[model samples]
Target: MTNAEPLFDPSLPGLADDPYPHYARLRRTDPVYEHPAGYWMVSRHDDATAVLRAPRMSVNEKNLAGAPADDSAPPPELPPAMVEATNVMNLSLLDVDPPDHTRLRSLVTKAFTPRAVAALEPVVTELVNEGLDRIADGGRVNLMDELAFPVPFAVISHMLGTPPADSDRIRELTGRIHRSPELLDEAELIEGMAAIEELVKISREMIDWKRANPADDLLTALIAAEHEGDKLTADELVAQVLLLYAAGHETTVSLIGGGVVALLQNPDQLDLLRRRPELAENAVEEFLRYDPPIQQTRRITTGPYPLRGKEIPGGSLVMVAIAAANRDEDHFGEDAGKLRIDRADARQHVSFGAGAHHCFGSALARMEARIAIGGLVDRFPSLELAGDVVWSDRVELRSAKVVPITV
Candidate 1:
């Protein structure tokens, strides 16, 4: 279809630059495509939403047919240290099933609820203003480094009560770790695993420090969190902290980075947002709908799944294309491909996903984006794209590595 064999291939030319066209083609020709890679790709909005909403759809790889019962066990070829690092990740909310997901999610669920996130509004505003202040006197600066990454990164770090000095190292390691799902070669996979190992070490050290220096922060609360006298194990703590540290900012980075680029590209929308900063809230949802950070999320079907009239075999790895679904014409209307900050149904987009496994940090991410993006627009009326947008090589975690801008 569209002359792009195995449309899921990340190495395809210009894919990182613009994937929406291909996604549109897939949605048109094959809404429920079974990829040659032994995975299924659901492109239509309805199908994607249905797959994500299905309670039986499993997030854990071990649920797949013929998969190892103990999915944490590494093959003989992989290094033991690598396996150990991945095992820690295996305990995170992103890679678990119902009971464990329910338990782990419930533990910290209150921390990120809308009301709790609202309490952090003052802190988020301060962080956003500080980030904007840094870029105010700038001529040309990479927004990714200056505003986009730092604001969310600072927010997450502040919440976690992590040592500020260790952030650069954490950023580097997390960048590497986020590349794991990019269909890596053996060597690349090994490198990613190594990064995970180092990050796990850092997380453990941080957790221990938090134990000694307990404070009124999310990290301390996590350390103290207990459900029916059952606390998160040491490994689970490491996994969760790492997940929060990485995801807490990374997705929002994409939001701010990609959103700004979209606005700059569409001058009309930029003008509208600048004139009416109140649209910032709606703009955040539009940004997510237009160009979502996490493009696709996967679900391992525990039983035969019917999607768009086809029966996908049990244990199938089905990719729910969130980005594509966000732009589905049937769902969002004919101009779904276009960016409209005022779109009434913007929040209806499945960018944060749906059902049980919806993103826990959605409230926080939205708050940060609203403040940060709104602050940027309000402060810099003449903010212009000064140079090319350097897109990240990541397919799943879609974001620009650099977005040079001048205010």
Candidate 2:
């Protein structure tokens, strides 16, 4: 029904803010779409699930921009900064395949357990309440700035045993790497990589400290994690911790900001939530379904795979659109497009992805949103947008830079 040749272009102006409409059109017409550049996308719910869980699909692709390679193609001269950026990209558990991914993720899962996350609820509640106290004196405030950003940043920091004094600088450093490196200039890109290196150094020092004086924290637990005569190396520990730090802080920030805006836009659902505070659990799920934090994640195929009954070639980048799949009518029923806070199957959405690569911090994210979003509605029933909301203008991250609200 739509004539858009490339529906998945990232450079479009408003694509990041509202991609569901585009996703709907594509899902109806072409569920398995391939790009001229050999990049394919699987947008349907079942296809998304299959591709994510398929043995043929791989996450260990070298997606570095403007970097040297040992392949057949002639090498191009690249700046040292860009090469350093590529090196940092390689350090992530995101770019590794099994055995390595299995090892790192097993250690991470042990530390980021549901029990560990549940124990943090009291502290998370106190953090949200303190933020509320600051906003109470001021009738109007930017929730993204005053509340949403700080709460998760604090929680992840506390979990990692990162010093409280270094919170602001660490937060600033993490902010530098949230967006794509290609979007930045030479100077900005260098600064971002430097921030990453600095964080790695900080993590390495902490790992050493934890070894000496063990504590009851995620970092200490990661240090204590060991397999049958095998354990994480120094670099693996630092990299995994950095990955956790980035993923933990960044995604939760998007959830809180985008979830609050969703409530403001739907007054009836907002009122229902204010009336029944317990709906917070279900509300968090719907918010992720309605507008997921991460839009698409890229993976490559190792061999031929069938998608939507069509066999695509091997070794092509398949961008799985989580935002689109969550909105598919076939999977979520007739009212899939609507933001129903009480939707029963809301938890079935792939907002946190599926299978092995699924987000490790989903439990922590949902709990934070329920407590923060739910607690706010309970305290300030009069919460509504003060002015126009501004979204983060990027293709990958679906979030807001500002949400002006009056409580």
Candidate 3:
């Protein structure tokens, strides 16, 4: 509704508010809808899954070196800041291919194992309790601002060894970076670039500090990692830290914020969840399927690939719409459109992506969501919307800017 038309336009400023309706139409009609922006949009769950799992589909955009000046002079060398930024970006596990990705992922994989996540349950619950207590006495509050934002912010900050003093500022910076890195205009992009410069500086200092004073945190683990006796370079370390800042809280916030908003919209489901709190597990799964945090991710085809009965050319850009795929009736049966917490296949939803690129932080995200949602309902069974809801003005990551509510 924010846009003039109802068609699913991923480029629309307000499409993030309610993209599901358009996604449904696409799934029913043009499962392989091609956007005018020169990209194939794979909507069906099966097709999206195939594209994601395809080894030929790659994210090898690591060429960040020179910027051309003019015909008169030679290629202008990248500035130090830009070089550092590029280094920070390229070393990310999310952007590299197999061998590098595998090595980088292994460095911190132990920290997110099931047992490790289970160990975090009590810590997450305590954080959730503190978040709730901040609004326990108030008649109304913006859940996104108070609980949803702070819970993941605090958890991830602690995990990364970010000082409590810098948590709020870092949270603000990370929020802008992760919400829709691909959606920023030139002005915002410049501003974000400046912010990243400052963040890169701070991250460098933190890495050095962690080296001197090792701790039992993910940062320390990453700082100590060595790939076949070849440690991560300074730029690589900086890049990994920046990636964490960009990704850590955004998806978790989206999950919690979107789940709370959706439950408010569907009180019947909320009531069902409240009565059988054991359904918290399934409820979190359904919430992810119903309204995922990160909607779509891009992939570049290295060879001709057939999808939805069409042969996409070798060098095409395809958007695997995770939001659309999750709700595809062909994949989720007749009640695909409905929010049923008890849906058996809810956990199978591609909200976290698929194949080798499946989210590295999924277990941590799920644990946080379950504890946050379960603890909230247990604390305030009478929670309800208090004011107008405001959705983030983005399409890639669907999240509420504010979910005003009364406890």
lDDT of all predictions, in order shown? 0.85, 0.79, 0.78
Best-performing candidate as measured by TM-score = 1
Better of 1 and 3 by lDDT: 1
Model 3 is weakest, by summed lDDT over 10 consecutive residues, at: 62-71
Off by over 4 Å in 2: 1-4, 62-89, 165-169, 180-195, 205-213, 224-229
Residues 287-376 of candidate 1 have per-residue lDDT tens digits of 999999999888998989887779999988888888889999999999999999999999999999999999989988888888888888
Greater-TM-score candidate between 1 and 2: 1
User: Rank order by lDDT, top first?
Assistant: 1, 2, 3
TM-score of each: 0.96, 0.88, 0.90
Q: If the candidates were sorted by their TM-score against the true structure, best first, what order would they fall in? A: 1, 3, 2
Expressed as tens digits, the lDDT of each residue in 37-140 for candidate 2 is 44687889999988888766778665333224543242255445444444554556777878788877877776568888899999999999998997798889
> What does candidate 3's lDDT look like per residue over 356-394, in tens digits?
888888999998999888888888988999987898776
Residue 40 error, candidate 3, Å: 1.6
Minimal lDDT window, size 10, model 1: 1-10
Question: For residue 91, what is the lDDT in candidate 1?
Answer: 91
